[model samples]
Target: MRQTRLRPPRLKAGDGVTVVSPSWRGGEVFPQRAARGAADLTARTGLRVSISSVKPGLCPESRAGRAEEFNRAVQDPATRAILWMIGGLTASELLPLIDYEAFGARPKVLCGYSDATVLHHALYARTGATTFYGPALLSQFAENGGTPELTMDSFAELTMRGWTGRFPTASEVIEEFVDWADDSRPRRAVPALPRKALRPGLAQGPLLAGCVPSALQLLGTPWLPDYRGHVLAFEFTDDNGYGPGQAARDLWQLRHAGLLDGVEGLVLGRPRGWSDAQREQLERIVLDVCHGTAFPIVTEFEFGHTDPVLTLPTGVPVELDNTTLTLLEPSVR
Candidate 1:
């Protein structure tokens, strides 16, 4: 018998959302900014916001404490959802200590992206609970101006309103950052471009998405989701040492790992600060590495490491065609 994927409860007005720094202590480091995010999220979703405490440092003790906090949220009935403060390199450390049983018992909306990919994949692999790849408290909600309409709309529709249908693209895009200390206005926006097709086709399958390098961390682990028959969506962050060459190697690595085997479709997010030439170069590399594969390949679908992204739900079915992406099921119960 096939197992049914678990869907968390949908959020509603007056419901509570617990904000935890499973990765970095962004809330503690930037109280004002974090508060702004909480306010905006509340205004948009009508969910009460509560910030959970996180221990400082990457020591075993701190990681354990962070996991404990996450577990507390998981087991708390009052916390209808769990939201990450921000993404960072430290999130993978908490995976070993997460109370997967508690999460499975009382699965609620778990949302975040980037480093939180470890948590998303691990929890799903262990329990099949659906989690979201969406805005973070400090990163998206705490934007200099309020969170963009495209970001919030995607988030609220899927998580709170039980919206399911074709995902919309933003009319404008913003990749530049405004200093947190001086966030008195919004980031500059440029005309939005349509998704470019590297390989044209259509398919439908369970959605699996995350930041590229972060997802690679689960390569040989029990936590990584089975990539077969899934609509895989990946995005890259320009931070650290990521460049065209690195992107090319990562794509090849994923392919070699069999992560691309039996995939229904491939969706790539637009990396921040990517020039037209760089985008074309990466596309060429993908074509080379994935040569002879027939799965549909679409690039620049507007998610991850960029302003205005879709709040994608893992473990849910979605449809991907040459021109549009559609969620086949509601993310929450």
Candidate 2:
């Protein structure tokens, strides 16, 4: 049964936001970069920002600590939103510790991507809270020079103010990473390739967007959402262990689980750190797995680990026809 989707109140200037690390402690590992991100976030949105009280550790106890920070942020009336410090592998570890009841009672804007996809699906399943699948602190705002205008503008339009209509794509994307140790160096970007139409058709349905591997990890768990009648959007991350092989297996896993049975459309983000050949292989793998599916399939739409991404609201209605994507409803009140 699908829960009643809740659209959190839109943010305004001076809205309070709490940054939490439910996964990797990017803030703890790179304090200078974190500081830069925090400053940039405030400057960009005029939202007063504060960091949650959590430390870096991979111990069992650390997960509990991270969950507590997330809970407090959700429960606090002063916090209009919760921002992720960064995405990592351990977000699933905090799933058991999250206070879904508190989150349901006090639905606040939640923004993140990559590993945070698990949390998004969990929230959508348990609370029906619409969360923004967008940039993380260190990853976007803390970019060496500054946050990309396209990324910040989308974040503001979708999460802070209400927005509806066609989504914009970034003409250039930051694919090259500048080491955190060299915080002064700006990231180099390459021109974005045109989006491809893997399967041609048209459809509009509620958007279900997330990281590929993180979302697959939720399969068979209560956190995995009901994808029937959804326009599923996913992106491959730059995680060292993931590649075209894993991508095939993951999509097949979804197909086997029947999660793709009623999907209305499919949108894929350009994979981070992927060569042209690898991307072509990925497209072939997708078509093979979703073979005979009548829905439209588009690839290389911007989102996920890449810089200058759109802030997509999970659970909102979206139209996808070939390479074009449009938001059909407001993501926030």
Candidate 3:
């Protein structure tokens, strides 16, 4: 989207990671779980995690305290990477407090998803720094039975070694509804059901995008990076309970804003709650907008709002083969 600027190498065993609460300060209200999540990262990664002071009593409103905590985490020399403690609705408020110039001076991995997308875009746009659209501490690490090994492996490849490759087509797709709190759910072989292609041609570019609404929220903001020559990758959760039409409207807005006008490719992460009819409607909308465009449009990637979510590195080079709808890239570093 902008001039390519890579961050420092991903963390290795013994490297330090910091956990900060940029969104909701659940660590103060829900201290036990938050503490457990920080501890869990050490156990899972065999790396030390430093907890930021701002995590406790993080205010959702625009407060200097929360911003200072996030800035401290970013500016810390010992911190090789920073992970969000949780994602909620109000993370956008902290955008102003982030000194992108300072972040640019010392680029490091900033990782999270959903609400954290705001920070990801802001950092990427202002500094050309690569950010990650991956699982957070509380949702990914602290859950019972610990983090999924696949998820951990993806994190390592993307963050530590920069391993990027086409995600292996899941052998068995699970269409059943499973509870997030259930420890057994992630272990199951939930193969992703394939959807028909919108356009039949391959395209390649840097991968970009996160939760749909979060991306849309930055449409007119200066923080929204240029999408040209980037493959748009997105998915949505049911948290907002948006209907099919509403979802279509968001995509339509992207088209109207010229965000989708000249993208090299498009990867539609599986929309979590769309019915079969709604899915078909989405397919039509995508096809309509991209009718004369010569880029590929692949759907049903097994990332975002899906179990066994594959962590993706934003701003990494990617190749999409429309015939197979397969995504290929070197391991993210």
Candidate 4:
């Protein structure tokens, strides 16, 4: 069965973006930082920003309320894009409560990463609407030192217009961080090593991913998009240190579930904090799981939980030839 993917209308400067907290209510503790993200988004994208009335603490207090806010954003004709402020463990809980009918009716650009993967796959599976597995308001937009310049520039370049060709490569990476503990803390760049390509091959197909842990959480549930024929991507974000041992086990679980079956390819983002040995182990795990398959696999090609991140439209078709990955079309109308 060939599923038709939905493209959102292209967003431009002066469009409206609603910011909401789908998972953790970190915004309550980082209100000022959250506001900074809102302001930065406006200043940077020229899009008017409207944060949902549900403040962080009170908002997360009720999962249904968060879903309602997301519903409101989806229904509001003014909101051309919806950006999650940050991610947490429980976005999956909102899956049952989301206003899919309201959202599917007028789908537009909806973007986030990490825990937001729940929504990305669910939205794609249930509505066929493409969602972005990219930066979040507080995580990337409001990143200290003004979020990474490359990240902001790339986001603007990709989303505001149709993105094709090679995504701009990061000369530097954001591998470390200082907490957004205070509104007054100065934004600073995290340390990075230049991005590297770990494997080489060519493959093409629709995109499917979730941080390994999130993938495990959503897989076999109603949320995960069909894995058949997808260019599957996996990265892990410290749910339990996710060391090489843990990561390999997670991949094992995914493979065991048959979720990795018949994928067109597999791409991996940088595993944060992994040593050279751990990264080596991850490669072995990929080989172990995909031993007999022709699926091309590559690692550390950016596009998850990492800074200088690439904005990827979940469910969109992509081409990967070695480290050179390309989008097949503009993600929007």
Candidate 5:
């Protein structure tokens, strides 16, 4: 791991935010909706936003454009935080082009998920700067009506107010989904389902991890951060559900790479839209990897690729209590 510098504080009302596409660039297709989301973000929090140059590009997947835009946005003195428009499979391509030293000197909240995980790990490993695993501009902000209150609240706690506290484990389970694209669905607050604890015990360490495959893709690369003494977290989208054999293979790769050797604990989010069999298989794989290890493991905490997801801060101290199965930490400075 690289030596980390002091991180920039969370954003506040009237502060400036920059939206950039460091991986995939589909912002141009929905410029109007994207603009509305940005406006809503500003209005909801009283923060100002500047759309990065990459937002209006022809091909956001192009490595040259992404690297140039990322460098410019992070270097801009006025930009308090950077938001990714979408997570692309090609974010790793920008790694060679990224100036990690520059980011280390001026650390800010770099946020995104999925493919953005590559950048998050790269930034933290190369520069020792903290980042966030949360919703993206289009994923969370660009809803037809507005951002979900739960997402908004989590974002505020993690990014602005810095209210890092133990995430509330659901006492009673309730599950529901709103098609933000559908105007007919009433937007209402729904209770989060109770979090299931895969193993029993409390564990504490710096929070790390992201989309499973994305993190796995970086295993052999020099950019992958050293997860020693860290709490590893992972979640997967509906598109690529890992089976028993697949999950075992992935964990084997991490083990072979020495990634999980010193990991203090594991926090597995409920895989969204995964079958019961797949979930069971994943749970077994997790157990096998941690077998004989002294670290506590907690599974099925609600975060990542799911509604009502909790936002986690990378590189922050976190405590997981097995009795409650909650990941606790301060959201910000």
Candidate 6:
């Protein structure tokens, strides 16, 4: 019972974008980062940016207010795309008030991740609107002076124009995370190990994933987009009172629900904010799950909450092999 895929229109230069806060308004908390992000989106990406929620205050005040702003942006003809500000644990609370019909009637590029993952799943399942698992306003694009080249490049490809190519190689990863304080603390760098093929083989299907912990919250909910026949990807981010055991359990939940019955491949994003012991334990859990299948598994991708991450188009077709993943179709156009 898969819905026909919905792809948003590719953006062009000067197209107006509305930065909506479907969750916490990170911009409100960090005004400097917020201003820098808005200005950078125009200066760096060449897109005309406007505001929906980045105001003179933190905390959106009410769920109804956030939903109203989001729906208004969707219905606005001038706004071609809507970018999320930042993800929070309470995104699901806004789901009830979202105008899904309006979203279905006019699909536009909706980009975000982490807590924004909830909105992506709900929109795709309820209205079949394709969404981007990419950067947000105050978090990714507004990083200090600017974001990394890798982040900017991939984001342009996925959001501004449709891309049909391999994921651009990430030379290194920023593993050292500094708590976001005033005046900006930067993400520290580490050498990126070459991606390893886990249980190598080949598989082709629509791509669907998010930070597994965020994704797990949608389990058993109608808003959880169907994962069947999709190349499933998962990663660890914003540890919500969980660890490797919880990660493994979430994977088992999918298997238990028979959601993975039609899946043929898997990808694991690089472990950010995790130790060697934790990563090892997590890998053991993954290997145990894949013991019987050569399902074209690959790990250590630069996505999730890690810095210099790739902007992935959810619900798009992709081909996976031992060494690489290639998009079979354009994500935006």
Better of 2 and 5 by TM-score: 2
Off by over 4 Å in 4: 1-3, 55-59, 182-199
lDDT of each: 0.86, 0.87, 0.73, 0.77, 0.73, 0.80
Q: Which wins on lDDT, candidate 2 or candidate 4?
A: 2
TM-score of candidate 3 versus the correct structure, residues matched by position: 0.87
- CA shift of 4, model 5, Å: 5.7
Q: How do all the candidates rank in terms of lDDT, highest first?
A: 2, 1, 6, 4, 5, 3
lDDT of 1 at 279: 85
The TM-score of candidate 1 is: 0.96
Candidate 1 ranges with C-alpha deviation above 4 Å? 1-4, 55-61
Q: Which tens-of-lDDT digit does each residue in 62-181 have in candidate 3?
A: 557778788887887888888888788877877777888888888887788888888888888888878888878776665555666666677767778766556554444334554544
Error of 2 at 219 (Å): 1.6
Find the 10 residues in a row with the least total lDDT in model 1: 53-62
RMSD of 5: 3.1
Angstrom error of the Cα, residue 92, model 2: value is 1.1
**Residues 1-333 of candidate 4: C-alpha lDDT, one tens digit per residue:** 224457788889889999888888777778888888889888878988877766445545588778877888988899999998888898888889887877678888998889898888888888888778888888778776576777777677667877777766676666665656753555434455544444557888877766878868886677777889888777888555568787778888988898778788888887766777887777787788777777777787677787777787777788988767788877777
Worst-scoring 10-residue span by lDDT in model 2 = 53-62
Residue range 199-260, candidate 6, lDDT tens digits = 78888888886877677778888888878778877777656466787778887876777666
TM-scores of all candidate predictions against the true structure? 0.96, 0.96, 0.87, 0.92, 0.87, 0.92
Model 2 clashing residue pairs (backbone): none
Candidate 6 residues lying further than 4 Å off, grouped into runs, are 1-5, 54-59, 184-186, 240-242
Q: Which is better, 4 or 6, measured by lDDT?
A: 6
